[model samples]
Structure formats: C-alpha cells, structure tokens
Target chain A: MNRIVIGRYIPGNSFLYRMDPRTKLIAMILLMVSVFLIQSFIHMLVALLLVALLLVFGGISVKRVYLGLRPLVFLLIFTFLFQVLFNRQGDLLYSLELHYTVLNLSIAMALVIMWGFTKRFLRFRLLYFLATVAGVFLLFHYLPFGIVLGEGTFSVYEQGLSTAFFIMVRLVIIITLSTILTITTKPTDLNLGLESILRPLRILRINAEEIAMIIAISLRYIPTLLDEANKIMLAQASRGVDFQEGKLKDKVIQVVSLLVPMFIISFQRSDDLANAMETRSFVPGQKRTRLHILHWSGLDTTALAFTCAALIGVILLRVVGW
Target chain B: MNMIDIENLSFTYGGKVEALKNVSLCVKKGEWVTILGHNGSGKSTLAKLIVGLLKPQKGTIRVDGVELSERTVHDIRKKVGIVFQNPDNQFVGVTVRDDIAFGLENLRIPREEMIERIEHYAKRVDMYSYLNKEPQALSGGQKQRVAIAGILAMRTEVIIFDEATSMLDPDGRKRILSYMRKLRDDGVTVVTITHDMREAVQSDRIVVLKDGEILKADKSEDVLKDKETLEKSNLELLLPLEVLHGLEHKKSTNEEIKEFLWQLSLNG
Candidate 1:
C-alpha cells in the first residue's frame, strides 16, 4: 500500500515544504500574533495580501482553504448574526421598524432547527431544509392567527459593520496561515518541533520527554483506538443496537456502551504497553537520544526572518496608531 | 555459561492463583527453545518472568550469568528483549524506521550507527521499502516483522517471542516462523512461547507446560513420540500424527503429498 498522507501533509516541494518544521511552527505562531495586531482596515488589507502571497508560495489553492473552513460554516454565520444584531455604536447607517408574528416566527424557527438537527441522518437534506424555511415564509399569508409583538426598531451602526468585517478578516488570516503550516509539515515533525520547544520545562522537574512521549503515543494510538471503537460498535450492532437511527436518549445509551468498552480496552492496552516499553529498555526519565536531529539551514533562517519582520511591521503599525 | 538459567521460579497472580510454580529450565547459548502449553497454562508468565516484566516470587533467573534482581533486571533487559503477541499494541513508533529506531534510541545508541542498524535490519526483514509507512497501514505480518527487527537492532543476545504469531493469519504465521529460523541461524538465543504444535516442533527443544508446572522437556522428536505423557498433560495433538511424521521425513515428499492433496480435495 502507498503511504498515507498523514494529517493534511500534501506532498509538494515548495518553499514552505523545504523549510524546517520548527521554523514553520515558529513562523506560524508569530504571524498569528501579527494578524491580531492590525488595528485598521489598511493593515487588515495588507495582512490579507501577505497571507494570500503565502498561499501561492505554499502551492495551496484558495479553494482548498475555503473547503477546510466548511465545517465552521455555522459558527461563522452565528458570529456574523450576533455582531450585526447587538452592537450599537457610531452613527446609524441603517434603521428598520417592523411588527412581527412572534408565535409564527418561533414556530418557523423551531421547525428549521429540527431540520438542522435531523438533516445529518437524512439522505435528502437540502430539500427538507429549504422546504422547511421557504414553506414557512411562503405560507405566512395563509396562517390563521399570530401573537403579534409590538413594532420594534433596530439600527445597524457604521462601527458595528466595521467591527464585523475586521473580525472576519482576522479569522481568515489566522486560518490561512494555519492551513499553510499543516499542509507543509508532517505531523511527526510537528510533534518533534513541539518537543524541542518544550525542553526548557526540565528545570522545573517537569519531564518534557514524558510529555512528548505521551503526545506521540496518543497520536500513534488514535487510529488504533478508532479501530477498537469500530469493532465494539460492530459488536453492539450485531446485538441489534440501532446506532444509526436513534433518539437523543437512545444515542446516549449507545454511546455509553461503546465508551465503557473503549475505556477498558485502552486501560488494558496501557498496562500491556508498560511491559512492552520496558522490554525495549525504555527507562522513564533516563538520559535518552534521538534519531531524527533537526537541522537549521539558510532556508530556515530566511523563513524565520520573514515572520519576524511581519511581526515587527505590525508592531510598528500599532505604534503609529493605525 | 547458559544463555538463560531459571531455577524453581514461581509467580502468582495477585497472591492467589499460581501462574508458574517451581519451574526450572536452562537455555544454552544460541539454542531455540519453545515453551508450549494450552491457554492459561502459564507459558506467557514464564517468558515475562525471564525478561523481568514480572518478578518471580520463588527463585532466581540468570541471563548470561547476571542474576535478575531489582538492580540487575534493567541490565538483564538490556541483554534480552521481547516481541509480544499483539502487533498493534507492541508497535511504538509512527513509521517502520522510527519503530526500529525506538529500541536503539532507548538504549542510547548514536544517530549514525542507529541509521545503519535500522537500514540493515529493515532490509533483513524485507521492510526497507516501507520505512516511511505508518504501522496502521501495515498488515499484521509486516508489523510483526518490524517488531523483530526492532529487537534485533538492539543487539540483544536473547530474544523472546511471546506467542507473537497468535494474532497473525496462516501466511503471517509462516513468515514469522521463517524469521525465527533465520534468527536461530544467526545464533541469537531464541525463545518462542506458543500454543501451536507446528511452531513448537521447529524448536531445538520443547518444554510442555500444564497447570503452571513443567510437564516434559526434551528434543522435538522425543516429545512428539511420547503421546502418553502429552495426553496426561492434557494438551491436544492438533496436528494429525501421520501427517506430522510425514512432514518430518521430508525425503518421502512426492507420493505422500500427492495422496494428501487428493484426500484434501476429496474432503473439500
């Protein structure tokens, strides 16, 4: 079998791909700080442009980053709605007054939520969701009665719109930088870099090696644990447990049954692993060495310098009160 | 000196059930020894005791003349390593090269030497092409081979297989058994703990265990011929007697195999 492209590492030999993982990790952190430092639209525009340049250099398409953000669609929409509805500052750019049927609106909202929750299990989802929303509004004229809320006025301010736009831009910049980091570096190398960064905790009597081992082992066992969970789920399914179609209560019970066995299996595995590690001559907290030595080259230096300059540039913008 | 010497060794689970009781055995240097028994027959317990995974309550275990104690057990483990039954549980690294490098790293072997030993042992196990592949992507047979290469690269004088092939398929079992043959040929003292009679019969000597005690210990042929003692020990002869003997005398191969194939196809 071919090698699994572990955790979003797209195989390519771009500038970011050739840079050291530690350099990339540090650069990602610095750039993320730089993103939040921008105080004005001009700086936000400049940040977005720099991030776009990074995307091109890393060979990642903007469409791929957009796909990665798909899972956060609901969260992003919620943030936009919350920002638009609540914030009242600066001049009122838009204002509206309307009387609404509180009862019918509540009923429509309840039905739309039901559709949202159940759509995951349904094959034909978009039609149900669209019908539930569109049907309620289309039938509004025919509805018999409604509990009318008095006329309510709401205003959208200039400052509110600007804040919403700023927050959205900042989020996109951070996520894009993260996407570049994840795509360019292997997960193992990422962990190795994290371990090297955490080595300073040794003076506090905290074992960095143990923490790193814990992380590496957890990462290693994720697939094994998933495999175990799958087998347990199958065993439960053979006994006629309906995991696919369930009410919230039934799903809770079903998940408990799976979790208990998964816990037992993992505990037993950990015990066995202690013996296995011992047999391999792994003494806890003992002096150890590494096979993979991190190398620093001119490429890494250049990459680190770029992130540092970006951070400093952001600081300079902040000082100039932009 | 014996490669491994155990005298009157005993281990109890939580101070109630005896896993191994008063069992004494000696493995000569470079010899392959198989501890064969049924499930719950304490064969695994004995292997763990020798490797210092568990402390023996009664007597002494000496590996190459270093007595196993709290102080010396770590050093003994440095000389003896084990490849366990579950290939998934035993794998410790993300990839084949990393897994092999793990044991060497723990032993504090330097980087360049570690790389050389990793390449050599991986090629020996026919997994050099899969050095970058994760353990989850490999089959049970391939993972077990990586486990063996890990122990072999540590340069341990003694290596134990604790029913290592039990979870593998027939093809996987055959591959592991062949590697056992290679390890024995390379003069690494090999101890194979198993319930399978086929795997047991390949060892230089067989020690049958029943109820946490040694039932019989002798050469492979001697133990096989003594069906009465084996039956008394309550181990089933899963291998049919005539076929086992037929396989042993490999020169009578032509007509016997043909007849067996005819019988097999007819039965099918």
Candidate 2:
C-alpha cells in the first residue's frame, strides 16, 4: 500500500518545481494531447526523447518514472498482448502450430488437466497468459482433433506489433508526464492551480471552488485513508483474518471483513471532519483566501509558451503530412 | 472569568442513548481541567458540546462570555478549539504546515500572518522542522502535536483535547502531556478529556463522569483522595496512588505512606 505513490508530491526545488502550477498544469494537458497525436514510430521515439529531457531537466530520475508505471505493468502488458494477438493487418511475422486431443480424453481426465492448468496459471499468471495465447494459436494451426474453424493458420502481423508498441509507448508517456506533474507540485498548489484554471467555468454555472476543495480534500485524505486501511488490515490479521493464506472463499470473507470496517471508519471520519470543518468556520462557497498565492514568473511563461509551441508544432506536422 | 460555562447540558443519540445528561461545568480562564471517564462515559460528548460540534437537547454553553447557539456558535468557536481523538482523522491538511494553516485559513487570516502563526505555533509544539512532512509520515504523537499547533494557530482562548493521547504510546503520550502542560502555563484554558489517571492527576481540576453524568468534580489532589468516586467512574489509580490509598485506608500518616511506597518500590 505504501508503494502506491500516485498523486503524491515530493518536495523539490527543481525548475519544474519553481514553475507556476497553472503553467505546469496547462503544459501537462498539452503534453498529454501531443502524446496521443504521435502517429509514427519515429514520433513515438521523439516523444520519448522529449519526456526523458523533461525528466532530466526537472531533476527527476528515469527509475522514478518507471516506479510510477510499476502499478500499471500488468494492464500495459495485457493491452499489448490483446492488441498484438487480435490485430491482423500488415505482413505476417510468424506462425505457431498446436496439437491437443480433447475428444480422446475422459471427463475425469479433462477435469484433472484443467485443475493442474488452473494451479499453474494462478502461480505464474503472466507466463501462463503468454502460454495460453501461444496454445490458442498452435491449436488453430496444427490441431484437427474435434473441429476445424477456418484456414487453421495462426500468424502475427507487423501492424499488430507496431500498433501494440505505439499504444504501450503512449500509455507510458501519459502516465510518466502525469507522475512528473504530481510529484513536482504540492497538493495545495495543485488545488489552487486547478481552481484558477477552472475559474472561467463559473460562467457555466459550475462551482469551481467547491470542486477544487473536493479534489484537494480527497488528495489530502488518500494517504491518510490508506494508512487507516493498513491499520485495519493489520487488526483483522491479528484477529486471524488469514488474508495471505486463505482459500478463494476465505479470501472473499477476509476482504469483506477489511472493507466493512474501513467503510464504517471512513463514514465516522467524514462525520468528524464535517464537524471539525464547521467549527473552523469553513462554509462551503464562501470566499476564502489562501496562504500560498501562485505567482507566474518568467520561467512559468517560458514553460507555458514552450508547451504551446510544441503542441502547435505537432499539429502542424500532422497537418502538413510530415 | 469563566472561559467555558455549561448549564444543564443534555444530549441524546437517536432519542435513545443519552450521551450527556444535565452536565453542567464551569472552567475558569487558564485552568487546566481534565475530564476522566471510562469507555462510553459522557466526557467525549461534553467535549463536543463545548466545541459546539453537538447541540444539547436542553442546555446552554457559553464560551468567553459568548452564548453558544446556531447564530452564535461560529463566534464561540473563535474562542474555543478542539483536538479530537484519532489523530489521523482530525488532521485536515496534507502537510504539517498546511494543517496548521487550515484553521487560520478558515478564519481568513492574511497570508503573511498565517505564515507567522504557523511558524510560531509549529515551533511551540516542536514540529517546526516537520512542517513540510505529510501527516501520515509522522508518528501518532507528532500528529497530535500538529493538531494542537493547528488549534493554537487560531489563537483560541480555550482548547479542548478529546482523548488526544489515547491513541499514542507511552512516550508519545508523555510528550503530548508535556505540550499540554506548556499550553496551560501559557495561559490557555486547557480541557483534556481522558481516562488516564496519571494525566488527570496533572490537571488543576479533575471531573469524573459515569453513565452520562458527573460523578465527581474537584481539585486534582482532592479528587485523587476520593477512592469511591474513582471506583464509580471505573478509573484505575496509578500503582503508587493505589498503594497510598491502601495505606491511607489503614489510617497511616502521609510520611508513613510515602515511606512504605518508597520501600515497596525499592524492594520490587
């Protein structure tokens, strides 16, 4: 739980840290849009280079960026695999052949095989997933035991591989840039920055201040709630919840045990917080001042201008068939 | 002048459970009053009542000469602050500095003065260096200290601590109690709601609550002598206090009781 570092701010005095939050926020949006605009492999590589440069100039390490992407490793790999396997455009790269005789096996034997496969899959999920994909292709290419579907050929496409690679790169760039923004900016500054940027939405009958306050409060409580949930987990463990060593049914029970108490504790906490805020004279929609007033310095303007130029350049490149 | 005055305060939860019943108490300015009670006793309820967190069904609370009502509660809150139990839940800011600034921001203090008060109170609580640290990164005691600093930054005349040290370890609790003592010395009316007899003994006055009613209210020394009241409140006496009480029951002199406790400590 402690390893989950999303939306956490690390204090630093780097160039990114010194930039106004509004500048960074706007720059983040532009960078995010530009990442999706990446069309060719060369554009993806250039985007990666720009991201690395930003990380270096911002005094953030590559390992830190990798750490930010660590939690999404499984999802990224899953998406990559789905895109690679299902996509059938472009030249064939390789083919696989598989053989299995399900018709010859008895029902009991089939159940045993399925049980063994399940055990192995649970133990080594990622490896088992790759194996399953390979097994499917091999079965289509070689096996003719029960029924035949089509040409019975399983082939990989260059377009599939490239598309998968592009998507993975896009996801990594977006996540890493977001991580950089959050890591460099303080929560209060982020709140104020978002509030000021969204201040124009007041004309649309939106409560930007309240929305900002909600976001700020949620950010503030994320780590705190995580800590409380950790404590509750430990307490339940001490009471023999057996979370780590449990059957599927037992695990469900243990999870419910943890969640129920967490929900109760959080509700009680919100009540206390409401009272505390009220006692502190925090009225919703009231004009409130902040201790840290954001000042847009020369660095902020330059950063914003650079992001806008980069965004326009990307759009221009795409429009002019570069 | 009385900093907090409660008259016939009664509160019920869901019209069934009486949390506080006809609880009336007066705390003078600069007085360090500790409310002692066991679990489910009405002390926490009273603390909430004083801070205007909960409205009494039939009573009145006056803080610093301002009556506490729906209209006047905000004004009363300006003079009365509370640091509740569960240090994690009470902290409203992501960082220590921001937490201290929370109350100040609510009061609309200017940024310059907010900075000054955040620094001053954080230093007073010895949490100046940790101003940038997240609340979750700090120990329970450190968080409680930050909570106190947050309240102090508001410059409230009376600060009520609702079991603030109940969640802390011995060392942490001792550190917080020392801070509370410092706050008392600085002329802040400190109301501590706790069941720890040791903490109660350090206060200027101890009010024992039992079954949603006041069991005993007296000076710390006088209250410590009332074994019946302590027993009724289910508040355990310290080992030394227990020994002293045992010796006093046998009609021993103060010197003899002290000598006996001393010898017992040495022998043990």
Error of 2 at B198 (Å): 1.4
Candidate 2 lDDT, tens digit per residue, B190-210?
999998888888899998899
lDDT of 2 at A267: 91
| lDDT, candidates in the order shown | 0.84, 0.84
Candidate 1: give the clashing pairs: none
Model 1 chain A worst lDDT run, 10 consecutive residues: A1-10
lDDT of 2 by residue, A1-322 (tens): 8887778787787999998899988999998998888687898899899898989989987787787898898999989988888999999897764434454223335444665568653866666656655555544445456743334345679999999999999999899999999999988899999999999999998989889888988888887778888889888878877776667998998889888988898899889888777777788877766887889899988888899988898898889877
Alpha-carbon error at B28 in model 2, in Å? 1.6
Q: Model 1, residue B57: what's the lDDT?
A: 91
Fnat (0 to 1) per candidate: 0.79, 0.62
RMSD of every prediction: 4.8, 4.2
